[model samples]
Target chain A: MRGLFKKRRLLMVVTALSMLVLAACGNSNNNSNPSASPSESSAAPATETASASASESAPIEKITLKALMHSSWLKGGMEAVLKDAVEKTGITLEIEKLPEGTDGDNLIKTRFATNDKPDLLFFYPAVKESDGLGKPEEQFVPQDDQPWMANFNKDVWIDAFASSGTFYAAPYGGSSMAVMIYNKKVFESLNLQIPTTMEEFWALSEAVSKAGKVPVYLSAKDAWTLQIPSLQSGAAQDNLQEITDNAYTNKGTMSDFTAKRQGITFLKDVVDKGYVNKDFLSDTYDNAQKALANGDAAMYPMATWVMTDISTKFPDQVNDIGSFLIPFNDTGKNMAGIFPPSAMYVVKGSKQEAAQKFVNYFESIETQNIYFGSEGGIPTIKGITNTQLTSAELDAQKLADEGKAGPVGVSPSSGIPQYVAGDYPAYLQDVVAGAKTPEQVQEAEQKELVKNAKAKDDPNFK
Target chain B: MLKRQYYRYSMLAPGFCIFLVFFVWPAVSNFFYAFTNLDATFKYTRLVGFDNFISIFEDSGSSIAFKNTFIFTVVTTISKVGLGFLLANFVNIKLRSTNFLRSALFFPVILSPIAVALAFTAIFHPSRGFLNVLLQSVHLDFLMQHWLTNRHIIMYSISFVETWKWTGLTVILFLAALQTIPKELTEAAKIDGATSWEQKRHIIFPLILPVVNTNIIISLIGGLKVFDIVYALTGGGPGNASNVINTMVYKSFSQGRNGEATAASLLLFVFILVLVSITNKYLNKDNRG
Candidate 1:
């Protein structure tokens, strides 16, 4: 009886295995069909045939490439644009979208360590040269070969990534621009105009406070949010070109960039004057967003991405939202500062032709307009218009075109420390929070920077 | 008999192999990584000897993080175990709606750490949060402050969240232990005119010591590795006021300072290992006695 039962079970297992194999085969067949309609398939084959002919005519054979991207960005539909471009170029792309936090970086690292490196890797634009392997000369190709980085100032973008005159990554999309998003209803109710200068900003903040409303919803608890506005305003106020140049040349100290100190002072003044809530430092991003949306606070310095979040959270107030560049000194620049490009890097050991083609396609104006517009991001490529821009984005774009605005790269305090070990942002937060003076913070940061520089030079030590 | 024994060993082999590969290998690698310069690139790894460790020693932030981590671990561990034991004792007794009370208590433990942190963040907000609003309504505004950002109170605030989340587990464990205690011993003590306090001290406490030790060790290990709550709550911010070891390690890793992160993690592991060993020795001695 036992043997009979076992035979029956064996038969069942074989049937299941056959079904699994059949299912696998079915999936592959479905994947190859690509088109939903017969007409679409018939139309697609002509393009595919032409592409194949072009490939055959070319002396160089096309190579397959793989890329890893963040899942959130992919969910926003940017992956389709990339895939379309790759398919057109006859490059087979194996794209993997990873979750946020350590998982993303860990997956990339694991793949790289196992000699299965992706052809292209999406990296935070702010990743410092020193954070990577050896000097870029020993790790990657020259910047001239990678043309996309040419838009940003060489000192800030190319040279920043270039160690010994080689570039590892091409700058792609920019981070969401930082600006003061205020409720238009609140402004009309308070009979206030948008502040145009730092002094005016403070005065307006005081007026808002006197009116019994939170002037600025600063979440110092989540320090990054607090730092963004400060950094933006500071960049607008400071001669970052000169500062960056000097820092790059090793002729100037990071302390020479005093606008950051001014930024912190502005935050401190806001806190001290009771313009912001007492619990501002303890508030999370969500809490601050809620406070702003629910009318607990009048204004907040947040990225353009907040527009979508606000619209989703408070559909009624979507039209009532207004944005302005965070003004610095009375410089009269309407644009606060543009976010530096978030970059896509080609791995050093990747097939160069395939990686270059992918990057080139990614940087093409059409691709930028299509992908960036759909994803609600400003395209880095100039002269491409995104018809899908919201009113706020259009305003920002107009401001950028009028030369009233400029693209400000990532803050040195955040970016540089990624390569070197130092608590630049944390120290600045302390200064803003009344824990440390600007001078004290600057001195501490300088010491750490010098120590890190020395550590980098220490060949015998490692 | 020999074949049966072989089958038993084979059955256990898969689980043991999994443990070795996933847990043991990573733990061992983390220890080795402490001595290398394995930054974000991971490709640029080089042996840096004790440079990362030396740097950690020199950095004031690291010292503060170490101090905060120890304080958080000790405070949260003790409070969680104590509160959990008390609640367990109360809930374990025969009562109407005991199951409901138990379920309610265990509910927070089942919640995602980030979600709990977010909920607590709202409750603890100084101006608009429910806690402060209640305080204001009761004319106790003076008592309310920025709970998560105030340097003086941030540690306690973080510890409170940890206590809130894990206290239920401790309570359940203690309740299970409490149930197994001899009814006869308590009855005898009561017959001899022992008060509740005296009986608890002599009979109940002694009987539950083993469970207490186990809870302490588990909570200690958990407390030592506390990351998500802090990450989602304050992110060890407002100038490293609430920086813990795990957050520090995370920051290092994010910034591509893999060597420093590994070193910090290794230090944390050693700290936990030493703590566990000490607790184990004490428990074993007590058992022998």
Candidate 2:
């Protein structure tokens, strides 16, 4: 009886193993069928032009394109655009949001590296060789031939990814410029004018502190925010073009770019002067905005997106907020720092027809109006003219129109690796906490640049 | 008889295949990748040999990570073991609230580390946190700290949270082992005119030495492998001041320096193996009883 029972149990185990192997084979068969359908449907449209009406009468074949986006890109009229694009085009977007900061960068890079690519990727226009996405020309399907390219404002929106003018991504959002989003009520109450030089800016800060309010609120907890003041100062420098070009390669160091280091020094000086809030390290961007709106703080150095964010969230205090460039030097000619529009790149050989159709619909003037109208900012596309600008928005635009705004920080052509560029905020935090001096931060950055340059097999470092 | 023996060995087939595919394959691949210049670019791959390991040793950040990891491990292991033993003894006593206290003490161990870290993030907030508020209310204002911001104390703050979360498990393990000791041994010590402290020291303490050894090793291994709490809390920052080896490995991987990250992970693997083996051998030496 024991021997018979053992035989029966062995038979059952063998049967279970056979079933598991069969199930694994069945899964692979199912996955291949969907990938083939996109190409079949794409071919059907071209061949069946005469029978287009009949094809339309039949059920519309829906294609779902997976889109990977940073959590930060989820804001700024993204929901409306995503929903509207699906409705207009037959492509359904399966959106996956990655975490902000270095974690998100790792996820996207790994996905690209492992060939676990999504159909669409929401990213910056610039593609660094070291950021894991080797070269945009090879990794992405170019959109230069798309019909929307004719309408795209080429003069205003420079395709930094396309050095050869072979566009691989499309601009789908408004640009953001770094400015000091301050409380006009506090400024007016203190009878202070906007400072044009470093000395004047300090005098104003000192005045605000005496009035029992925080002079400059630094949201140091969010490491990204720490680099804004320095980047804005760097943008205002007359030799910015030279600095970025030389600093990125092994040709120049941070010590040579005095303007860039001035920003870090400015941050250190603010902490030393006790002009910032006591809880700068723990204070987040959201809390800082609230403090600024509630009149607890006088000024906040941030980008233009906060203008619309503050206006929408604090409707009552909308008129009381304003923006201006941060004066890092005593030169009296500081310029606003502008970041290019965030873009969407199509992965090579994946749902290209559906992805392109969705991109075309998204870049239309009507859709652009819908986006910029809700999320107030400077539109990168040509036809959106009636955006309702906030007071702070107008102030930043005024700076840009007066030829006082230029590209800031690391541009795509800056040749600085994205990972190395990303470390600037962390280094600034080290400086803020008094763990490292500005010179040490510069030295640390120089070491990182050389190490990454060698890794990229750059001849300059050799 | 041979055919029946073959049938019996076939039972091991399914489990062995799974182990080979999942665990062994990845571990072997990790070892292989550690030697090459693998990165996110994936364009060129070649064996750079010990260069990846050499780079890790040279980097200043890696040194800081090693130092921070050491401090975190020491602080967490000691606190978890020490506090867990104290709590276990308290609940082991016969009292009306014994069951309730035991349940409450073990509850935190079951909580998610991410959720626990997030809760502590708010508690450690410098200005508006519950901790600072409580301190201010009690007129202990001077005791208030920049918990997550101050570079010097950030690792300790993270270690404290880790200790708080895992101590309950340690307590339960110690409790189970403590109960195994015969009550007659303590009672006999008491009859011999030994005080409570003396009874605990001579009888109860010596008896629970095995459990103590086990708890220390378990806590030590846990502290060495910690990643989630540190990542969720500070992200190894205030300028990498609170970085552990795992977070540094993550940062390296994120920066597309895959080879260096893999090398660091292998180093971490060997470090754990050597340390745990030595500790296990030393602790078990007195276990003949």
- CA-lDDT, candidates in order: 0.69, 0.80
What is every candidate's C-alpha DockQ against the true complex, given to 2 decimals? 0.37, 0.60
Which has the greatest lDDT? 2
Model 1, docking class: acceptable
Candidate 1 lDDT, A295-389, residue by residue in tens: 77888887766665565567677667777766766655445566655567765542544566667777776677667665555654566666345
Supply the TM-score of chain A against the true chain A for every candidate structure. 0.70, 0.88
Fnat of each prediction, in sequence: 0.56, 0.61
Model 2 lDDT tens row, B89-130: 999999999999999999999999999988999998988899
Return the TM-score for chain B, candidate 2: 0.96
Superposed model 2: Cα runs more than 4 Å off: A1-61, A159-164, A238-243, A410-422, B41-44
Model 2's CAPRI class? Answer: medium
After the best TM-score superposition of candidate 1, give how far the Cα of residue A122 lies from its true spot, in angstroms: 3.6
TM-score of chain B of each: 0.92, 0.96
